[model samples]
Target chain A: MTGVIVTTINLTAIYALVALGISLTWSGLGFLNLSTGAMYAGAAYGAWLVATNISSNVVVVLLGGVIVGAALGALICLTVFLPLDGKPNWELRTLTATLALSFVGTNIYLWQFGPQFKQFDPLFDFIREFRIGETLVQPSKTGTVIATGILIAIILAFISYSRIGLGVRALTQSVEGAALVGINRRTTAFAILGVSGAFIGLAAVLLGQIYFVEPNSGYSPMIKGLIVALLGGLGSLRGAVIAAFLVAFAEAVTLQYLGGSWVLITLFVLIAVVLIIRPRGIAGVLEGTRA
Target chain B: MPRGREDLLHYAGLAALFVLALAVPFAFGTLSILGSMGVFLLLLSWSISWRRQGGDTLAGVRDRSAWLFWGMAGVIAILIPIIAGTSYFLAVMVTFLIYLSWNVMWGLVLGTAGLQSFATVAVAGISAYVAGYLSVELGKSGNLACVGGGERILGVPVFQWWVAIPVAVLVGLIVGFIISLPAIRLRGIYFALLTIGLVELARAYVVQDKCNFGGGQGLYGASSFIPESIAGDLAGYQLAYVAAAGLAALALIIYWRVNYGRLGLLLRTARESEPVAEVLGTDIVRARLWVFLISSAVLGGAGGFYIAYYGSISPSFFNFSTVLFLFSMIMIGGINSPRGILVGTMLLMYVDKRFVDVDPPEARYVFIGLLLFVVTIVARDGLISIPDQIRRRRGVQGRGTNPEGDPPEDVGAIEQEAHMPPGSRPEPS
Candidate 1:
């Protein structure tokens, strides 16, 4: 039972980190950003390269992931968003374009890194494991959960209180209204992309410690983030965080009882049911307003 | 010019195009790339010239030209096997025709009806599995002898290629109808996501059902559709090519009928604005459902043909990448035009086939991605509109002769005219 709880919490933390980024971009910028998964994979590879080739320092590796993630985020913004700005069907165009980028990004990784899965041994070796009531636990998992909690809290506080966050909120509410109020759409959009990318990078580094990083590793997490974002309501940060935990718990319990394959089947079925019942998602508002 | 002379010129142009198309394979020899390019260029030039000769608003003339184009293209397709005279070249043609059929079906639902369905591969997979399972089951029965003097109707052989095709198509229509039931409630991206879910569920079901569906390793050795006498020869390719071309031609006709017919206009209107269509008393739900059903049946039939042509069915072939490829093909070709769909499929499939042989496999995705990106940004209507874009640009630069290049006070007039019926002038109030 304790193992299940720990796993659920750890998974929830990771999903929260990724889902937060997806929510921010979707709600704030009206961009689905399907390449978030690619960003995650890219960051994992970036951190892995740093740890394996340069130094085994955790900070350096994480810094590499952040830099890569930010760079990719900026690149997507410039190429997809900037070029097609002010178009009639900008949202759908960007969505498809990002999807294309996601495909290309995964293939690029496969071409450059070969097909073999790589591990971040340095990070794994550094983390210490402890036992609690006959259950063995890795501090790294607990550390990740705690760190994610802190980061999410910081993000929540920033979004709630900061000036830039206010600008993002305004933009999310209404693009025209935001423009009328003199908010710089370009700067806010870029900032959101940067911050979301960094969050994905951080999540990637932590996830790489637990799983093997490969060309296709980003696909599942991308799907998960998409489901969580939609379930939580696009652009709803609070709903995203809560939905992450809910999904993580369901996944953990399903894995514990049914087996591995049933986990995805059950999760997807659950999402379908939820979508049928609530098309706007758990916290989604009516059509006009962004969550 | 007189009407007779104008009509003569049109027929002459079409005849020249047909002759050029027939000569392409012979001129280029066994290399399919050059042959494909020559044919594509010939078609492109023909279409461009046809568009430039735009004075014929008479529906009869338009219909005749359309038929002429298709008829000549059909003749050229039939001549490909004889002119190319190689199994490799014929195989490439077969692949192009199959993709052409697939994309046209996709264009019906996605392009004309404006539904963002990603379940083309899933529907195809379902049909393929049905065909494969039936073939295998019937083949097994055909190998068995009846015991104890009992008539064994259940154990009788029914795995003929001809039998499998109709049964698979029927199964496809039923499955298509069933899937579209729930899909009618969903809209846009939500509907797209639902299809994705359906695909995942189908894949998982196929992968897990080891007893009936052959699980992951996949069932093999289904009897080939090609006859035993010419199974390994160029005749087999020719047979497959003919079947594929026939299917593609049928799909194109359906697409054309839908686009030009009343049902197509209703679907398009629904796509543009569902609320407005609803206000006009159009059965939006029924229209979407019918289009979905037709598209699904077409996709399912294509899948059946694929299994027949390839002699096997597997889950991996119908995965996410397949969906992406189909989606990108429609986008690249111009979703609105059947001709664009054909051009897009041929262009991308040719490039992809060559890349598989020459370049690193990963480069294909990058190339496709770049194409999608460039096409989405540069030619929103796809490569089909590129000629018009070029014309507009040249006109803008040269003499500003085209009013479309820079409409000063005509914006409001254009907007107002868009809502009015064609050939109906506004009342002078």
Candidate 2:
């Protein structure tokens, strides 16, 4: 039972980190960026390459991941979003374009890194394991949980207080309203995307410590991010955080009782049920008009 | 040139293209680059001439010209197997036809209905699995002396392929209906994401259940629709080609009927503006449901054909990449054009087949992805609209109107207006 709780918490933290980016992008831009998974994977590979070749320091590796992910996010904004901004059918066009970029990024990963899995040197390996109520807990897992919690709190605070974050919030409410208020929509969009990308990059570093990273590693995490973001409501940061824990716990319990293979099947079924019951999601506000 | 002479030239061009398609297969091998290039050039020129004659419209001259073009295409399709004269080329042609069938079904939902569906592969997988399982079960019963040499279902002998096709379609309709129950609640990108989740769920269920689904090793030794006695060697390939082509023709006919009929109008109306469609008293739900059922049924039938041709089914065969490839083909060709589906499928499949020989196998994904991105950005209507886009860019005023005669509304503008707070609706673009 304790093992399950620990695992659930750890997963919830990591998933929340990933979901933050997805939620932010959706609310801020009204764009469903499907390339988050590719960004995650790219960040993982970037961190792995840096750790293996340059320095084993945790900070250096994490920074490398952040830079790579932010760059990717910015590049997408410039190449796809910037050119097609304010166009007719922008929503569908951007969605398809991001999906294409996702596939292309995965293929690039396959070409450069090959199909084999790579891992970062464990930063917390030397730390002693702790026992909580007869359950053995790895320090790395605990470290990740703590670190992710801090990151989420910081992001929440940043979004609440920062000027650019306020611009993002205004855009989320109404793009025209934001423009009327003199917010630079283009620059603000770029900044929000970069910050979201940095979150995904940080999540990637945390995830890479727990599992092997591969060309296809981004897909599963991307799916998880999507589910959490939808479950919490597209733009609700608090809801995403809460829903992340709920989903993580559900996944943990399912994994324990139903076995490993059934986890994804159950998750999908859960998502379908949620959509059926509450199309706007648990925390989503009604758009009050036909979408 | 006079209108009569221009029409005459269009018909002659189509005839020459048909003759070229017939001769190319025999002149060089089917896979030869020269043959492919020659056929591509001829088809392009023929289409341009047809378009120049305004064949897309319903005018009397264009109507006859449309018939002429389709008739020539039909003749070429019929001549392919005979001209190739080899099972290898026949097999390739069969693959192309099968993909075309898949795309035509997709075009109905994604193109006409404006639903971004990712469930085609999932539905196809279900159909193929059912057919393969039934064939294996019957084969087992026959070996046990429970039935005669002919295929038997529950101790009753029957034409297995005949049973398989309809059953697959029925299953597809049922599955499509069930998916739609949850699907119709979501809008836009959410709907597309839900389909992706559903697909992943189905794949997981298949992979995890080894006993029934054949697991990772997959099922084999299923009976083929073509009997060994009649289908000796190349004959089987020829039969597959003919069956697939027939199916493609049927799909095209269905596509034509839907696009030109009352159903097409309702679907397009709902797609463009659901609120307007509702105000007009259209039963949007019924229209969408019918689209789903028809599309799913066709996809299921194609799946049955797939199992018949390959004699096996596996989870890996219907993975995410397969769905993406199908989507890309439709998007690149022309989502709204039935003919565009054929052209897109052929072009992408050709690129895929040739890319197999490239040093790094994965590079093809990048190429395909880039193509999809570029096409989506440069030509919002896909490859079919490239000519129109060029004409517009060349300052051809009044030619910017879509062939369908509907003025292109700014989708973003409408969405923004809809979501804008009361008293703040933007002025209509």
Candidate 3:
């Protein structure tokens, strides 16, 4: 049970990181971009690209993901929407176009690198065991999850309260209104996409450490991140975090009881059911925040 | 010729070239590369017209020009292979006629209803798997050969192909309806995403379980529709061309019926603004259901023809690339125009095949990437609508309007500078 819980927490932390980026894109950008996987894959590929240079520093590996992800995110948004400017169909077009680009990115990477799975470092070295009653269990990944979860919370809170945060909120509500207030829409949008992209890139690096990285690697988890964003309601950061844990835990438990292959099947089913039952997601849209 | 008249003449001349296209098998005198193209053009015409029929006010006999053009072209296509003695092309052309019927149905749903679907791929895939499995088990042998390769599905008796098409369509409709039940709740990205889930599920169930091996190498010759030796050979080309032509014609008519028909326009209203359409008293749910079912039935029929054309079907071909590419074909052609879309596929495939010639198979990615880049830059509205876009820009005609109002409409207005998702506010409370 403890082992399962630890795995759940670990996976949830990764989901939280990925979902936060997805939430930002959905809530802030008015996009349902499913290309987070491409960004995440970029990081893993970045690490693989410079594996000899970076060696094994966990921070370095993640930074590789972050920098590449942010760059790609900015590139995608600017390139995708600029051409589609003013078209009310921008949202759907953006989603479809981005998806195509993502495929291109994935295939490009695959063609250049060739198809192979690479193993990265696992953060934890030792597993510790403890028992409450008669049940025996070992807890691994406890530290990684705890430490990262705290960092994400702090960073998110800081953004929420800061002056820059205020400007971001304005843009989210109304680009014209923000411009009316002299928030500099162009600079601000660029800044936000860049920062948000990099942040998710870091999340991808963290995920790569736990799972095997390949072209299709980020897709399964990216789907989860999108679900968490939707389930938690668009733009709800806390909701995404919580939903991440819920999904991760449910998935881990399901895998523990049923088998490994069933985890994805379960998540897909879960999202379908949840979305049908609650279209607005579990978090509900924030009233105070700019929609 | 006057420039405008010349342009119309070019269209008419190209439109009239269906006679030449039909005669292709005979002209080429071989089931070589050109004959293969003949087969492809016919199937593409199916989906292309369905897309064209979208957002139109008329659907039936009233919208006769496009239908008439398609029919004339299709008849011309049929005669070419017959005159050229290209039985292979004729046979392939025959299968595509069946495909055209199905693809038009999908186009009606997709073009008319405001739905972004990926499940149609899965629906067709499932149909193919079913037909293949039944055909193979019943006694068909040669299942591993790639398309156009000189191979035959030896064991299965020929009669089954006759039964497979309708069965495949029925299965497609049933699946489409089932998917829409949950699918209706999803809007925008969520609905498209759900289809991906279904696709993966199909892959896992069909391919991995090996009951169908539905996940991996799709299906091999389950039924003996045509012999490969004759189809791939020079003499076989005419047969394939004629068959492809007939199917294209049949599909054009059905698609025209739905798209230019009353139901298709109702679908258009729903897609353009479902809520507004509902406010205006259109049964939004019913429209969604109707269009989706139409698409599935069409897709299923296509799937049956799909088996006949390829002599095999595999899950690998049905993966994300297939979905993305087909969607790209739709976008590159123009969302609601069938004529443009079919033409788009021909252009894209031709360009794609060119890349295959120049690059190592793996490096073909670079060419497609570059081509996609160019297309996105030059034809953001797709190739078919380029003139319309230019006219709109020049104010010669101000027809295509952006539905969403807030953001700047001209993509050119936004600078090519990297930025956040515009919504990435710090205080996304």
Candidate 4:
């Protein structure tokens, strides 16, 4: 049905946004950035505060979330990444630092906002949806899909063509080589993490309109993002996009057929089966990306 | 100092600490106060031997020393409940022991095998759930069939505290095997991420299925060491402490056997370099799988003890917070050091118990989080490695040579080398 299709696309867009954030950071910075979840929650709260106090305009709300998310990302970069960059076990150490960051961030949110769920007012009331074959599509979801598509396209283009993106690509390929080319690793890392954090923020804002935001809101999405990133292979952008759709489809189908609780269970089973068949994930098989 | 004098000093310090631990009950005489003193004594003893890595190479001395340390610690652990004379303190110690055992097994996977897996909690959680369900069901039906108050399964009583331990081990092995299926194909972050997802899966499945998994309240009325007739009495507390201490001893033995045994050597080789290990004819995957299975069994036993200790199992056992707490404990302890893990567990447990009275409970987590963040940045190997770092700084001893021309054999160095992307490693200038 059109309703299910719309939902699936919406879920896919959100997952892609999160997955792209994870994938980009891992490739560019050699850090897993598990704190993405905290960033997502922080961004959602930012968007919520903006919508509640300032303006409910879509662009304003989105920017509010993106800026807060980017700031938090940069915060993590400053606190965790910069000090530990190039250190021994940078990957695992950064991962632990990020995990610790999330723990701190989540608790801060809990302390400040309390544990109650906050709902977002409709941000896409101007949009209209058309019915197809007795199934009515949701306008909010339609807006999310279109908005996320444009944002992802813009991010991909930025990563591929922009000067900073070039440096990030170089860093991803080889840190020493990028250094030799005079790329400021610290500034470049900030840019990379900030952009990815913005991506997660945007996803959180888009999803906020659909779901309530809370302190622990980002944990599930972070898990979903990790699933997509893992199945797509850690650093492969194209693979992440493809895996996003795959995971979203599986999640949507399971949610529809088995109920909401079964979504994660089904997706995990899917990842397990897929990863068993191709250990490196779909991207590892298709693009031969490093695991 | 001469070697003989150094050895004498170590024993003298350990003996003095044993006396201190023995004196803890009389000095503080209360739950929190007494527990704090006991923890401090344990830390002091651990720190004394922490820098003596040289002694670790001498198997006989190390074994005898470890036995003396653990044996004394075990005695103190057993006596704490009786001396405290409060069921409340016993309950806290029991929980601490469970987490200690659980974290130790997790250390095996993360430290020894060098796989950053998070399914340790999930394995233990599953074991707890299964053991609890089995005990409840078997106790109800088997009691009727046997015409006795207690039922026996494999010569272990269905409702007994120790019964869950073995059952949990079996469940853990099965779950560990299943989880390790995809583990063979994946390595490093990919595998770690997968394990995290698995934890989420287990949590969601348990939470969503209210009918089967008891919804949010979780499964209850499972058998424990404490009898219903005297569940609130001092005897019940003593029994629980003794059972937990026994489980902790078993876990320590398992950790020692696997970590010091040939499997640990094989894993060290595989962790150093997979291709080289393959060239040397070591089945890296099988070795990891074996490690995973053994650790999982230990985790399962811990989980089994959890149900018996608490008389219930909940979805929160598989929570993200639980994972963070356990991970922080291991990381703080020096993920690779068992003795450090004990230190980490004791420190974190004390901090957690100490902060239980703080208002706006989130502050406690923030404090713990800040502690973890600071430690991760400041000490690469955790609190346990600080002494070594200090010694190195003062030029007491120089860095050891790596005969294989590899990076320094520190925890992070090896993990970094093992997981680095092919071109990402800096070329020799």
Candidate 5:
């Protein structure tokens, strides 16, 4: 039971890492970035490239994810967003464009990395055997959960407090005001998109180690992240993180108790019921997004 | 302002095209003439409706004015096959008519109202499941129960022929109203997401019960509820289809007529500024509901017709991608344009269906994503609008006007007032 609990925590934390990044981009850019799925699959492949062909240092693999993901994210923002200049129909354009790009990215990665699954090593097995009163827990996944959640929360708080964070908030408020206040809209928007992409990359690397890395690995997480954000409240940073772990934990529990297919139907129903009742989400935006 | 020879020529062109549509099956032996015609008519109708609305025009169309000439040319081109002894092509024309039936309603809800939705396909899916289930249950007993009513279903005889269509239509109204209840609260894409969620929900619901709807396993043989003995043979069903289509099309024309004048202006204005419409004594909610309910009836009517043709149902038929396709149909054809809806569906659906090699079902998704991407970028208004663009360019050239000079002066001033300098203003690249 303890071992299973550890794995669940690890999975939930890993999901939060990806969901946090996705929610930030959505709040800033005003659409779910479908490309994160591709970037994730790319990261797993990237890890494989380093692990097999070069040095497999844990830090090195993660850095590879960040580099590849950031470059791709930056490139897409320039190509798709800048040219369009953030058109009014962000929901449609971003969804459609990123969706197409995801396909191309997936195909290219599939060709490069091949279609089968590949295994990679985790940072460490820290949940081995810990005695607490009358019980001892030995699970490799427990450490991952505690460590990942702490790391993500810290990163998010740091960014939110930073000057760039202030600029992002201002940009979201009124694009014109931000520029007038001497915030570089282009650079600022790029930073938000990039940082979000980087987080997704990190999550991808983590997932690759925990599970089998395949071409289609990112889609489930990507979709889960989107639902988490929406379920929490679109554009709420903290809500997405909290919702992420909640949903992950729910899925884990459902899988443990019920069946896999039932989880989707149940989650979908829960979301529909909530959204219909309160469009703002579980916690209203004003409550969640405070200065 | 005036209907002239050009307008006459346009209708004549439609007739000629209709005739040619009847003739095409003989020309291409492999082609299902009705399917081809259904697709073609869909495009034609889309073109007609979209052009009337001030929908988006890209690739230099920028709102071309000469709709009559294009309409006429379309007919003249189609007339050749009909004149060449291919009246049999009319059989294929019915298929295209069916497309128009559904899409027109979709244009009303999605296009005219500016209420973004993605649930029509799902509604169609639910109705399809309802339709197939009813037809199949009636069929299983080998009873002519579907043909009228010897067998009473809850003290009401099972409807056959035209009755089934209405039953389906009523169900559509129910589904539409159910979806509308949710749509009232949600904004644009949120409404769309809700629709998708409902569709998934419907998919789940449809797959569960064996008595009402055949599960994912699919419905077995279904009878065409149309009374063939009275109509004659297969050609008899054609008459019913055309008659039904004629009525539906006439209904659409009436819809268009209502929309063309003061009432339409009221709705259009309402879409841009609801408060203004409210100030002007328009019951915004009632007017919206009016259009919504009317559109639902038509959508339901279309679903009835589709079941008449397919004679089967499976939950698999309706999904997210179908919604995407419907969106593309309107977007590619023209927004808020009835004719454009028809033309766009035919042109895009045909091209997509033909060119797309969907050997694997998964590949179909990637194919559609790519298609939507390309079309969204190249012609956001849809393919039926292509001719309009060409015509506009021709007019611009006729005037000998020099294009591409000034950045609209008002844009800069507006940006400046918003506290963003012109340089820092959004790049209109």
Candidate 6:
């Protein structure tokens, strides 16, 4: 039971980070950055590279993932979002383009990294495991959960209170109106994507501790993030966060009771039921604003 | 008078093309080095010299040469298996036809219906598994290789190859209806994402369910239209190839009837503005559901053919990479254009089979991805629109002085309108 709780909290943290990234990009840029998975994979590989070559200090490893993830995000923004923005069928085109870019990104990673799964040196070696009542808790997982909470709190605070956040909100409300007020859509897009990429990058590092980092590792996280973002509503950060927790709890419990194979089936059924009930999702924003 | 002369000329040209196609099987006999080179050069020249307009080119030739083109294509498709004859290329052509059939239906879902449901392969794969299970494993004539140990399932009738196709169709319809549920409610990317999740769900279920789905090892020895005694022979592959060609032709017909038919018109109007389409009493959702169901049923049948041809299937069929490959084919082909779909599938297959035979083996995916990325970025509508883009570019540069360029007057107007957002453009009056 404790294991399930720990797993759920850890998964919630990772899913929230990725879901927030997707939600932020969709609302801010009106682009469903499908390469979010590629960014996640790239970030994990980046952190792995750092742990192997440089010191495995937790901060240094995470910074590597964040930096690489942000770079990939910026690359996508320039390559896919920037080039295809304002084009005819912008939504569909960008969606397809980003998906194509992900294929490219994943293959490039596979080409460069080979197909071997890599394990990171335990980053939380200094922290020791402890017990709460009869439950034995591993320190790395606890550390991951707490660190993710702090990082997400910081990201959420920045998005909620910062000047750039204001720009993103305005742009999400109306592109033309925001542009009319001298808000640069390009800059806002870059910033949002970059930050979201960093968020998922950190997620990659954290999750990588639990799972093997491979060329294809990003896909599951990407799919999970997409589901959470859609369930919470495309642009609703709060809804995404809430949806992340709900999904994580469901997944962990399914894994605990129904076994891992049935997890996705149950999750899909749950998502379909929810979607049928709430067409716009829990807090579906940008309903009338977008086509 | 002149009309008779024109018709005579058209008949003469078509006859010459037919003769050329008939001679191809005997002429090349195999996909040799020199033969492939010659074919490459011929196709390059043909594409370059083809009409330069966008969809209008097809519309322009619709009355005159459209039938001629399709007829010629049909002849070549029939000849391909004979041309490849027992060579490894025959297998490639068979797979190509199957993918062509699959992509045509997927194009309907993506381009015509404007829904990005990514569960196409899942629908096909699930149908194949179910059909293969029912017909091969539990049928009255069960194979010894199956888990049933040749014992027929209780109360089940003889499910031979004939029953497999219809069983697949029924399964495809059920799966299609289920996937379309969210599509009816959710719009755009949400439906796409949900379908993506559903694909993962399917993969997980198949991989985990060992008894029924055969887990990762996959079920083998599927019932084929060809007799079991000769299934391993060259004749079996040839027959399968012909059947596959027939299937591709059937899918093409479906694509035509749905896209050019009344449902396509209503869907297009709905695609533009659903509220407006609703106001016009279009029953847009019903139209979408019908298209989705039709395409899904055909794809399910194709899936049945897939297992029949390959004799087995595994969970890999439901993998996201397969979805990527299929989507790339659609992207590289101009979406909704049958000609583009054919061109795209052939080009990708050529590259997949011939070019980029590199170490690590997985590098081919990189090539495919790059091809897709480049096409998506540059062509936007896939490789089909490249000729138009070139003509528009030349018209801009030469101001109609260039002999090959289209008229410059409306080219500029078309370019301007093309670049503008559809909503911002003046409503067509």
Could you list the iRMS of every candidate? 2.8, 2.6, 3.2, 2.8, 4.3, 3.6
Off by over 4 Å in 4: A285-291, B1-29, B33-72, B141-164, B393-407, B410-429
Candidate 1 docking DockQ: 0.49
Question: Lowest lDDT 10-mer window, candidate 1 chain A?
Answer: A84-93
State, as a TM-score between 0 and 1, how close model 5 is to the true structure: 0.73
Question: Model 5 chain B, poorest ten-residue lDDT window?
Answer: B404-413
lDDT of 2 by residue, A74-132 (tens): 98789788877766557777887898889899999999999998988886665678999
Pairs in clash, predicted candidate 1? none
The best-first sequence of candidates by DockQ reads 4, 2, 1, 6, 3, 5
- The value of fnat for model 6 is 0.75
Error of 4 at B308 (Å): 2.5
- Residue pairs in steric clash, candidate 4? none
State the lDDT of candidate 6 residue by residue for B198-245, as single tens digits: 778888887877777677887776767877676767887777778888
Instruction: Give each prediction's DockQ, rounded to 2 decimals.
Output: 0.49, 0.56, 0.28, 0.57, 0.24, 0.47
The runs of at least 3 residues in candidate 5 whose Cα sits more than 4 Å from the true structure, single-residue gaps closed, are: A1-11, A32-68, A86-147, A150-166, A202-223, A249-258, A284-291, B1-100, B138-163, B208-212, B226-267, B356-371, B378-429
Cα lDDT tens digits, model 3, B41-150, are 44334333333432221212233345554563455454445453544445444543443444445455554454777786789888877766665655445443322222
Report the lDDT tens digits of candidate 5 across residue range A145-178. 6556655675667577988878888876666678
Q: Which prediction has the highest TM-score against the true structure?
A: 2
Native contacts matched by each model: 0.45, 0.77, 0.29, 0.79, 0.23, 0.75
- Model 3, range A1-291, lDDT digits (tens) per residue? 865776787788888878888877666667766677777787778865655465655555555676787788788768764565455456556776677677777887787766788776554444465574554443435545654665576556756897776777777667678879999655555556666676677666666666777887878778788877777877777788889888999888998898876776788788888878986678856433543
TM-score of chain A of each: 0.93, 0.95, 0.86, 0.95, 0.86, 0.95
Q: Say which candidate scores most in lDDT.
A: 4
Which scores greater on DockQ, model 1 or model 2? Answer: 2
Off by over 4 Å in 6: A156-163, B1-65, B140-157, B355-357, B388-429
TM-score of model 2 vs. true structure: 0.89
On a 0 to 100 scale, what is the lDDT of residue A249 in model 1?
A: 89
